[model samples]
Target: MRMPQGKPGRRAAVPPWLRARHPDPVQDDPRICPDQTRGQLGLFPTPPRQFARTHAARISDRTVPGFEAVREELRKMADERQIRARTIWLWRLEGIARLALAARDPDREQVAPQALKDLLYSGPILGQALHRAGLLAPTASHRLVPPRGTGPTRQGGQRDLDLRGQCAHCLAWANDRRVLCAACTSWGYHIRKHGGGEAECNRCRRTLMVSDGMCRMCRIIVAETEVDTARIAMDYGDQLWFARPHAAGLAVGPRTSGTAAARGRFAHKRRLARARAADELQPSEHVLNPAQLELFPAPTRDWSRLNTATPPALTTAAADLVADFFAYMRGRGWNINFFRGSIRTLRILTGHLGADAPIRECDIRALVSTGIHVQGARLINYLRLRGLLEAQPPRDLSVARARRSASTISSPAFAAAVHTFIDVLLGQGSTPSRPRSSKTIENYVATVLDTIETWIAQGLGDPREVTKKHIEDALKPLHGDQARRLHTALRSLFRALKRERLVFRDPARSISLPSNRPVPAGLPSDRVAGLLDRIDDPRERLMVAFVAIYALLPGQLVQLQRTDFDRSKGRLRLRRAGRMDHIVYLDEFTLRLAAAWELHRHHRWPDSSNPHLFVNRNTAVDETGPPISTAAVTLLFQRVGLPAGRLRIDRIVDEAHHSADPLRLIELFGLSTASATGYVLSAHPDRKPGPIAP
Candidate 1:
């Protein structure tokens, strides 16, 4: 025998060659000489294959009963299985087979008795309790046992029966005859019947039926789930499923009630309604803060002196409230400064309830008057909070009016006189009910006379009795030019009177008086250079320069002259420039231009005033200005011979051809579209201004 070699550390395994060669003294003929036999057999046969030989012999021995009979017995066994499969199975003793099928394969309950037991149970298609928990019971073959970690197991625990399975009471006595599982103890049947029984419905897996039936929509959407007619294997609910809210009600309670989900719909609806207008108006702080200055009413008196006086002291809370209100309005894109809306509310409040809005209500009417849209809704909100908004409308204001009649104006003469002149002044019967200045009154008188004469020829002498139809007739004969002017007057008056009780109730209560517009001011040419030369103030010189480069009015330039400039950042602002108080931005050229002029001029402005750059000095002589009159500005333009009549109306006073070519300049500066560019159309000393793009 050959000894195996091994290292000192490891004892070597014995080689197979050394163990047994069967002592073949010689390499016996490759198969006993290919055909040689021992004794009476012609074949030496292959070396015994022990297990195979044993099985074959047993198979052959069984044939002694008679080959055909053995075959018949095998057939009988197979036929018996087939017969058992044909009939419906009624469960009997709970065994490993039954329990395993119940766990790993739910459909096994309805399958043929002989359908491959383990295959049917462990099949991918037949799913039972679908969860992290594993099989109900281990199968007869230990290999078929389900993986662990299902619900706590008790079948093989210490006690005869555990809390998870059969309990002590289930036996009734010490070791009573039977040991049943918890399911069998609780109900006569196993959990297979009590469980949801595949209770999922396509319409609502979350829903359960009150009487243990399908949910309402489920019944409508899922039909005929019998196995034979798997004809209707469904992935989802049928088409045309019932709608929500109503559909949600169906899930109320198959076995338990849940009405909260249904109630949630109403809450969601209310939330949506309140938030619908949240995105309506939102303005940035930078834009609104500077612009709101224009929103303040032109003070009842010249506040030029008032500006020097200290503003009224605000209470800390009042100040904070005002700050926040300004912040809030700016956030909503409003360039509002005065409590115009709030004070109007104050006015109304003072009118009603004697002196103020309920302190608790804090007023909203002011916001509305300022062109903000939220006040009506805000008023409604507070009233609701106060438990008053939802209350029925109060008995008509007429009752209140009757009670207050003593204060009512008794003479019709004042109102009537104003009414009779309405047609002549407004070119119609009524104008907006707005307060007017002496200038507005004069304009009104001039326009009224014109309208009356024109109407008289068309047969309308008195506008007091003029109905809408009659006014239209009177308006028909006027040219578009005249009609447009009349419309403007009417529109202006109506907007102003919207809040007045008389105006709200009567369309005719509008103001017939014309607008007392401040005659737009500008400096004259002969006066402008003279005025500029006289001003020694560097600040005012810078201010004049800005007015020239950017068309800003005097007051507008004054308010915007402080820390906002950043020479490095390249931005300049015309803080507030219009009735709307629009904030205007300028590029770096502005800063450099102002700096250059200041260094060269060596002038200084009033020491007591704000860092504001401008101050008018010689206006009393002709127009009250450090420079010149509004009249002077216009006359200067006329002398220069640029298109004067139209540009003045548009407020675009300065013009230079950005492109040198006349036609190109006209096109680039937007001259073709409106009156603003008309300068390019006129013959110019030079072709135009700047280099053309093309």
Candidate 2:
């Protein structure tokens, strides 16, 4: 090759004639033209592409404002030995310049450093550099006039100076002019200079210093150290922290005095107080804080102040009632911590109704209309208990909820018929030998409400308009218990309505449910032997035996009383509503279980006044003598891994298998004739039904 160019590494220059003929070469086609052979072979060739070279812009000619100022400041910093000549130093200066340009002020010559706060990749380092270059203006006056020096104020020590001083590192206006900024003083300094460095901690022996004597790990343990309060009290020979001396259970220590000893003793006492205050109320006894005992024996000063300091607008009678209600709650051992909401609600009610008038359900209803129904319910209950209520005691909560379902009916006539049926069922206007329970009324209304709404939707608004066709159509989609309940509810509703003359006809009278009851089946042979072994709770074990052995229903089991047990006779009297009471003979196993449960209840809840045979921790404390709920009895079965109803049915069926007599099953388990017959058939499928018991 000939000489390349003037320089060894440079390209050779082209002649003027050659350059004129070829100017600049245009970009070539990326793909090669396909030949016949290539096409047949499915080959497509691509040629290399020519990419234009890009030149990087020079930093000196960057569009950022104040870039020259940044460079000069960096040079000054280097001269002053503030920063070294490193690539990072140049990058930092450029970053400062870019941030300063973006945060530049249009109204003034300099931008406030606060303007640079939120920009991308911006920080105090960039702002500090720009501030040192005189690009940022100080808007905040130095203490409004003369700048404060880096020293303590008269009131506070270093905190005052730190607040007044502007930090050079942060570029804040709070730094003092005479000395370095308090915060920035440590920015470039070693921790050793400030009495902090890696040294072995005294407690943990770790090479990380937190304080003069401890590392961070050891310091946390020291802060959270637990002390023996009883030892401190015994050492001091002062007032007892515990109610009983034995309760403290701490050894005496030598007594000490001095400021440090006083502080340690005070801390121990505070910890003890907090621990005692946090102890929860025991199930058998009330373990209230010592300070809260005053609330039980008598009202505290604050309570007395509230009682006597009634507003002038409130009547004397209303104020007395409010005081009595609070006293009643206090007597019931209610914690006073929950009294704030009730106090506010009662105050609002008594203040508005005026002391001149007695608070009545009508007045409470007016408040309820204004959206305070929860408070109204409380007020109504209080009035009823005080015998101040004139209206009948509020109906069962279930009945109210069931009535709400009837309110959704589109037709007023059908809705009224349903409500009247519910009222009659609850013994509101019509009296029957045995009034239906709230739950029974609720169930009846729930089953028929959907059918009533369906009839309304099908253009039969009146119950009189409901014919056999309507009842049949509604019953088409329902089956099993749902179908049976619907049929029973319809027949009862129309029959009651016809008696009341609300409906002229009874269409559901002839609609019959399946007379055949489902046969009761026993549990598997493998599970029966070990079912009672799994229940460890004395109460649960007793309950399981009642359900699994005696075949007692959950409802009857929950209603059992201590008097009903008849321990002398070894018999349990199950007094269920709507059915004659039945006496169950307890075998030796069940009697022993019952005795153990009674002993457990007596020991666990000795102070309890509840008379129920199976008193739980919750019901034991209640003075109303309400027995443990059916849900509690069901939970006992669940804990044993078998359903209560299934266990009871299994017991009845097993009994039937042994006897195969319907009459014995009925008298033994208090089951109806149909139920007894079903169990008998389930036990022995070839057995015929016995005569129905009258």
Highest-scoring model, TM-score: 2
Q: What is the TM-score of each candidate against the true structure?
A: 0.24, 0.49
**Model 2 segments beyond 4 Å from truth?**
1-392, 429-433, 576-580, 603-605, 616-618, 635-639, 661-667, 672-674, 686-694
Task: Report the C-alpha lDDT of model 1 over 1-694, residue by residue, as the tens digit.
Answer: 3345664556566567765754424322232212222222111112211122222222221212122332333344435556564222211111222322222222222322222243333322222221112322333322221122222434765432222221222211112123433322433333245553334443345333221444433432332221112233344333332223334433322322232233444456435544553333232222212223455533222222321111233333334434554564454343355334543332232222221122223233332444452234323332444333223333433323322331232334323433433322334434543333333444543443444455445654333333445445545676555765665554443333333222433233442334343322333545444434554545544554455545555435445554555456655544432223333445565675567654543332222223433323222111112333345444444544432333332233334333324444333222334333344333243543568635
Error of 2 at 139 (Å): 38
The pairs that clash in candidate 2 are 165-174, 165-175, 166-174, 166-175, 315-355
For model 1, what is the alpha-carbon lDDT of residue 300? 25
